[model samples]
Target: MKTLKIGNTTVDTVLEWSGNLFDVGAFWPGRSWDAVEAERDWMEPHFIAPKDKSKPGVLAASIHTYVIRTPRHTILVDTCNGNHKTRKTIPPFNNLNTDYMEKMAALGVKPEEVDYVMCTHLHLDHVGWNTKLENGRWVPTFPKARYIFAKTEYDHWFANMNGHAMDGSFEDSVLPVVEAGRADLVENDFAIDDSIWLEPAPGHTPGSVCINLVSGGGSALFTGDCFHHPIQIANPDWSTQFCSDLAGSATARRKIIDKICDTDTYILAAHFMDPTAGRIVRNKDRWKLKI
Candidate 1:
């Protein structure tokens, strides 16, 4: 777990899993490995796995949640893949049995203690922990918490609920929370308080968003998939294969980089590996993360 203090609030990372999970070629189609290889000096052992004969072009990634404890609220940003969910389309996330809840408990936060559950989007991995299996029925995992979702995002998934690309996550993890009356579908610019709010960052998904936190002279951005890896900092045009609109995703990514580059804001990207927090910096003509 990694902890950071922002103003009077506390942020803790609850990691479910991390590893070299995706093939670079597939993750970023048509992108040349030469560009990524050029940065091997700094990426080795973390962002990009050390080259191995069998697993060439693999990219390191993680699935985790950020627990933000403000003066009055215990908020969770982006719940990772939950345990016992059936994700047939994405084999890696299928029937996961992680100790994610125990990890949260270890952080002194029980399910009922959470004040809000904020999802950046409705992707399979991003919203999987919204609910859990209970008595042969899916139920809201955080019974007392109000799950926040972008209205556009929810509507997109709700309309495509049948055979959606999320591998049944909408029905299993998301719909259950809505049916249980624990969901709050809000606009992309919704704000929880003065210290935290959602910023519109579409492209990966029509309603994708990035949560902003500004408090106590400290600030941070919980970027959901805007930049999956630091490599995107160097190559801002690279959009992941999962992006719904390639051009729009790249545009949003560049806009975000331009907004935070050379600034004090720490970026806590959802898929970044350990030492997951850093600031955006300009390197010569491109951008990079200064951790």
Candidate 2:
């Protein structure tokens, strides 16, 4: 567990996995190799995995959760891919096992101590930890936590819950919590408290949102898949091929970068590799993450 401070609040990172996940061309179809190579001096070995004889030219990402401890609550921003969950479409995340809970316990947070389980969206990776295996059935992992879901986001997926592989995710990861009566469907702009709230940030997903924190004059934005890699900061128009709405994703991505440029607000990226958090800076005509 690594900790950082935002005013009086403390933020801890509990990692699940970090390494090369996909090839650059495969991940960002529209991104030119020249653009990525230009940032090679800064991207090597972390954001962009350096060439290895065995596996060359791969893009890397980290899956982790931000444990935010406010005075009155222990909040989890986004839960990474949970253990033993089914992910057939993406083999890298399929039917896994890991010591994620043990990592959290090391940080002094037990499942029951979690007050709220907030997700930016209901994607397989983001909501996988919402429930766990129990008596051979999916059950809410946090006994005392209230799971928060954005109404628009939930409805979008719920409407097509059976249309694809994601239906399996909703069944195993999301439905169990809602069935337990521990879920709260709120507006995209809902506030958890005076200092913590959600802001509408669509594009990656129709109902995707960013968690905002402002305490003791300090600010940070928990970017939930709005931009998976730091390269997006430099090329805001370069939306990932995985994005369901390319135009909307580009629009929302730029909006977030514009909102944080030259500000003290820390960007806590959900899938950024090491040095996952940083401030946005104006690099001439573009924005760069100053980690």
Query: Which candidate's TM-score is highest?
Result: 1
**Measured by TM-score, how close is model 2 to the native structure?**
0.95
Clashing pairs in 1: none
Off by over 4 Å in 1: 51-54, 162-165
- Estimate candidate 1's alpha-carbon lDDT, on a 0 to 1 scale: 0.88
For 1-291, candidate 2 gives per-residue lDDT tens digits of 357788999998989987777576778884666687667666666677665522554667899989999899999988888989878887888888999999999999999999999999888888889989988999998999999999998998998785433638888988899999999999999999899999999988889899999999999999898888888888888877767788899898888888988999999989998878888898878778887
RMSD for each of the candidates: 1.5, 1.7
Once superposed on the true structure, which residue ranges of model 2 sit more than 4 Å away at CA? 50-55, 162-167
lDDT of residue 256 for candidate 1: 88
Q: Please report, as a residue range, the 10-residue window in candidate 2 with the lowest summed lDDT.
A: 49-58
